[model samples]
Target chain A: MNAADLPSSCDLVVIGGGPAGLAAAALAARAGVQTVLFDENAGVGGQIYRGITATPVEDRAILGADYWAGVGLVDEARASGAVIVNGAIVWSLDPARRVGVSIAGKARLIQARQVIVATGSLERPLPIPGWTLPGVMTAGAAQTALKAQGLVPDGRTVMAGAGPLLWLLAAQLLRAGAKIEAILDTAPRMNWLRAAWHLPDFALSPYWSKGLALLREVKAKVPVIRVDRVEAHGRDRFAEVAFGSASGERRMKADLLLLHHGVVPNVNLALAAGVAHRWNGRQLCFEPVVDQDFGTSIPGIAVAGDGAGIAGGTAAAERGRIAAIAAVAALKPDAILPQVQAIRQRLAREEMGRAFLDVLYQPAPGHRRPVGDTIVCRCEEVTARQVRDAADLGCEGPNQMKAFLRCGMGPCQGRLCGLTVTELIAEQRRSNPAEVGYYRLRPPVKPISLAELASLPISDAERKAVER
Target chain B: MFKRLGSTGTEVMLKVDGKPVRARSGDTVAAALLAAGIDHCRTTPVTGAPRAPYCLMGVCFDCLVTIDGVGSRQGCLVPVREGMAVETQLGRREAGR
Candidate 1:
């Protein structure tokens, strides 16, 4: 936990502190391995359970029971004696199991025998025009603001997007005293058609009542606006929004415009580490390929939690535990059992609820690959037309487009544009997203100061090895 | 867009561009600024247009600001301390001491 005297190596280096990372690191360390978990946040709750440790909201009702569910697991991890280093950003990972990290601006390199990446998911790229305007942000952003800092959206606030999180956020916002505007639902029609067939399955699942209740509450107070298409419009800050609803094109003025299509696995670190990933059509994002053991394509590296794929916090914790048990077995064969029966039973139950949720919350089809001057890349302000032109000019994928139009080469590092870029190229080339491929991710995954790099304490052995 | 939902935490005083701003004990620099009616956090490097804390979770770089003489720190991520000085980030970072 000492940034000044950080270990050059450890047994396991779990790269996130969300539900999965915390579970994996805690279990692995308790199973007799030197495990250290690094999270960029000051606390351990990943995005889903963000600010659980430091949530300023005294009334937990504002956050709901599902969010509070992870509290026990977080407490367990905190008590498990795993070295939890918050505010430690892992910027790079090498094949040799070396992790480059910045802990409160001090840089260090930690080598590990086994690495588990449970970095978790990010809000999907909502590339509607004027999305980059000052007041426009993701639903997750607004939720994080409320949860982490107890700040509520003032003025007229409009919530737009699909999924349970969007509704949950709306409910929480209403409780926080945010002014009413409308909830523009961009959820795909196919989900509604498919949801009924799977409704029985969802009802039987444990999360059934919770999800339904959230939906009911949001629908009760807020005026749900179903829009065929939605776009934020403003010059300095988002002043108004234009969208086509059931009636026709309409414009509404709002102060804060929060947008969320869905979430995607945060795979920048995984891709940079050369972990194999496959495009998940249902989720519409690339998830790292992991076996039942949660081991990724590379040996000594396991991926768990929503970072591997978005299964939410509960499933992520189960996946993390499964990965930890498998990791300990891999490292110290005698320590693990032939089969973790109880854990498997729990995991099975946790997984049942996920299928129906994923099906129901998938982003609307049109929203994924937007049309008509929609800005695909918010950082560089690249449009769908420009990306198609790049493809027409023989640009094969995101990398080629990067060279051709500087689409994915921005400060946000394609986080807001990677998926859209891939889809755009895929559409133009008459192929699928997997065929078009994703941007070649590199590290420092998050930015690191040049001064911090220059100040890394080179051990005597490292200096000697470098000379050779 | 900002309002404090609860008053459990103690208040702390900080400065934004030499103006004293009051914030709670656990409030982030971005939250304090937003609560104080300061909408624009920084201006874009290329277009020179204003930007704010779009993503409070440190993912979006739009909340970049100079904190305690350090440049390009995401205002949402940095917890506010008493008497801390924060300035709007301008363009690319200069190596700060």
Candidate 2:
């Protein structure tokens, strides 16, 4: 389990099992390199493409069926000789591509010549008053529950959020026989006009049609409402959700309230490893700056997927393939760059199309600014007013806000509030949110116990080597 | 590409707490459990809210249940194995707590 105990070295070590990691491992193994794929989840595919346990009621369901197909891809990669390790929570990554992994209560070090990072992203929760209530859940979580687990959040549910995921989850809930009270789409009014440019790209596949079909089906089944704001009301658990509509503040009694603002990259590993990143103004994320080959400032290390930025599964898969090809070329110079270039070009086209769609579907500016009493950081119980107060008191950046108000210093490490805090600060400071920038993500993304780190089987020699 | 569901009639049987449950061979434990009308999987320690696989994927811990004496097994991830002893976890009693 120690570094030396590894097979001397592997050609590539992929840090996630989502589309990006799965694609990278499959391509690297196909190229005749020894590869190892590791994921914290027992199953592969990150959050967006979470595996479904049951046979989907409909074959053309966008999220469920497509996600199950990823399992087949994982099997194909394993069949191609890539070592697949599930339920392996990778804690740290050394500069030398040495990964610290905890598998089944055992800690081990995996060394590889090249590393591909595809850790993916997490849901960005808006700190509304009753957001932390028991019945309140993320839209992704709701979809995962119904699609994969075959359990409804409740018999009656209200879906609210601002992304494609919101509509997608709403449709799925309708199919599961859950009486959807209403779907509140918080996407800005301007997005549809802006997103029209990307319609041609979406027409490339029937997948987009399937998503629209789901929406239409949901519209037929339930009332779809477009609201500017939503407020969850309850003493302990969520009892009802109130939305501000043109008519007035309408309240609906519901057992389940699903919210989806958007997603932020899981940047803890990159920050822990000291990778240089810049604030992406458009996507509102801190993404590592990479070259054409996905190589970061740290050579031999590459990043892909939403962890790199907020691109979808298709982009992540392409980026993974590109990183794998680049990693192979690093070890074997004879590998031609033309092949990589062709792949990069195709990926760029797809990425541009997705980016256009994202811009078209971005959340409205008002959702970024919740009511004063709304908690911004549920982990630390910091309210939106506290973040604003901290900003007024010379706390400019999210990191400083964390220091002054402890806003982003929680278990989530600001993945939920980092962008929202930045935007709030920017609004108060009369500057761009990008100017305030992102919070630094420390290592051990998911809190690892001190004992777990100490028990890692990395030998003194390996430790010394890493230190050197 | 495989044809969409509603076309396949592939059937598989796996044990849930030593009882045979009918499921498609590739279906996850959570999927099969749902198809079989087994709702309550585990309980949250703090609130004791009955949590049935919130996120069938491993991201959400709501679906954690004991499978073959292994506590906190993700029902969505683990393929239903023959003779697998599946038990509902009462609360968060792992050592990490």
Per-model DockQ against the true two-chain complex? 0.71, 0.14
lDDT of 2 at A347: 76
Model 1 pairs whose backbones collide:
none
User: Best-fitting candidate, measured by DockQ?
Assistant: 1
DockQ of 1: 0.71
lDDT of 2 by residue, A214-274 (tens): 6787788778777877888876567889888666788888877888877767777877777
Off by over 4 Å in 2: A1-8, A52-65, A196-208, A335-338, A458-468, B1-97
Proportion of native contacts kept per candidate: 0.70, 0.14
Best by lDDT: 1
Candidates' interface RMSDs, in order? 1.3, 7.7
Q: Go through the candidates in order and give the C-alpha RMSD of each one to the true structure.
A: 2.0, 5.8
